[model samples]
Target: MVDTLQLILPGFLLPYLDRFMQFGQELFGGAWQDILTVVWTVIKVMLIIAPLLLGVAYTTFAERKVIGWMQVRIGPNRVGPWGLIQPLADGLKLLLKEVTIPSGADKFVFLIAPVFAFTPAVLAWAVIPFSDFLVLANVNASLLFIMAVTSISVYGIILAGWSSNSKYAFLGSMRSAAQMISYEVAMGLSLVVVLMISNSLNVVDIVQAQGQGRFADMGLNFLSWNWLPLLPMFVVYLVSIFAECGRAPFDLPEGESEIVGYHVEYAGMSFAVFQLAEYSAMILGTALISLLFLGGWSSPFGFLPDSAFWLFFKMFALLVVFFWARATFPRYRYDQVMRLGWKVFIPVCLVWLLIVGCWMMSPWNIWK
Candidate 1:
């Protein structure tokens, strides 16, 4: 069993099963440097993945706890002290449960759909700037890369519905596809405003752009951020992010009382994966909103030191607003969602883009 486990395990786990073996190889027989380099890369990957996983877990806890407070009730105090361990308990429960597929379901696609849905949310984090120097990939076209990667997840939703062999699931997937596509246009257009102001597709550059101007010089960094000059686009982007993440006020895809959801046929861990994807996407959205409009790791006042702490503080503030919105607003009706995206947001973004373009050519262009 031990031998079998070692053979089947991933390379990272293999080191744990027999650490000395990896280093005892002839290729690196006595070279400590080579062995440490390989191990360091693994550590770097974990440095990113670990916090993200924890963030997703706690995000679930925060949602329930915050909503509980808003509704005048206590939430999830059963599993551990103050429900601090609730996410872990939920994970164990999901892991222990059996996942079932409908007899008529396409087993292969049905099994893969959750993975397809989940991967992009994780992948997009590769380009996110946690601080001035802390990012996995500092690509020049990070914005474009994020836009492309995120757009692929809709296919997973489409597959989920198609493979389920259930009309309700199919309907849910169709709604999801349409909803995502509509809001994505608005999302993209709002981002265009950021790019125009920053004059770069790099996320780090976007944050850097917000750090310029007189307000920054006087130590009131918040006033210099893109949010002030581009308030309309910021508003449109925030609303579009809510829709993109399938949160309340835009959660038409998984209208639980109506279509049940695209993953309605999913059970146990399969369903859990969908939830993970959703929450991760929410965090991703918050991260993007922080980087683009809220100034990434730049402190509200320049008194704070440059560190990942400020980045996460800003990220947390935005995340709290996400929960607050869920508590405050009722979900929009499907027709209303479509109308707001197409009629209102897109047009507003387009007009704003033209306005920004003209301003860039005018004598008052601050970006100059």
Candidate 2:
């Protein structure tokens, strides 16, 4: 599909806007024909980034509103009608604010830290399969790629804290590093169970694996998904992701009472950048949950079109659960969070992995 578009685009547009198209093509790539491919890549990237940015903006607004309703109060009604434009107002305010660097801070590292954090979250989307042949890049080892990229964001936190030259920020970053490392183990192990069941590392193949099994043939498609067979691992993955992204109850890195946490020294857009990274990771995690556990873009009924709507619907549902946890749960003690990740979740994931292995080898293997 993408190749077809790439070939068709230049043939149709090059005649009308020859000079401008040639400039873009030559600037982005080596040859004129390469222009269409470059343009197509850019369009796919924009398609992913634009919706992600909008989702992040509205996620903030939705969090405030949902939490407010939970607490029996109206939220963000002053900025625009029913606070529809609250996120826009907040974004503009941040953009207009002055970015400040402390006297002793490492200027270059401090400046680049936010970009380091933000880049990985967005880049990981390249391999995600929204629907059949709809991804920007369909790598064979996509799950591995996502794990590797997501892990790099930890450096941004450490850099932000160290470059700021502040003890409180350093302590917060240390906690974040510890938290991420502990949870990441459990998270990866949980996914190992998924890979074993689906028998594929390619995300599109994994989704397709869930589409036509016995339960799906019986018109109980939802029951046929990996979430049912790997229920324990599914739960572990969900909790570990919460800790991995530093969401509420596990948000030790940004604890409000702990001297305002890691990015406390950051001001204006720099601080906002950290926030953007965090929220982007949240949304990415939501998408992974949908694809890996809830059956990516799969319709419950056979009659529905195989489109991206189902994927986004599942992602949105998971996002609501994320905000719900934030509103309902109190912050865990740093030690308790670490204990949950290392001692509890890790052991559970390991045991479940063994159980799943045995189940897969047995004559009762449902996935077979």
Clashing pairs in 1: none
| Best by the TM-score measure | 2
- Candidate 2 has its poorest 10 consecutive residues by lDDT at 1-10
Q: Candidate 2, overall lDDT?
A: 0.88
State each model's CA lDDT, in order. Answer: 0.88, 0.88
Task: Name model 1 segments beyond 4 Å from true.
Answer: 1-38
- Mark the 10 consecutive residues where model 1 has the least summed lDDT: 18-27
Q: Per-residue alpha-carbon lDDT of model 2 for 165-234, expressed as tens digits?
A: 9998888888888888888999999999999988989999899998868888887778888898889898
Q: What is candidate 1's lDDT per residue for 29-103, written digit by digit as tens?
A: 668557766776677678888989999999999999988998999988998799999999999999999999997
Kindly report the root-mean-square deviation of model 2 from the true structure over all alpha carbons: 3.1
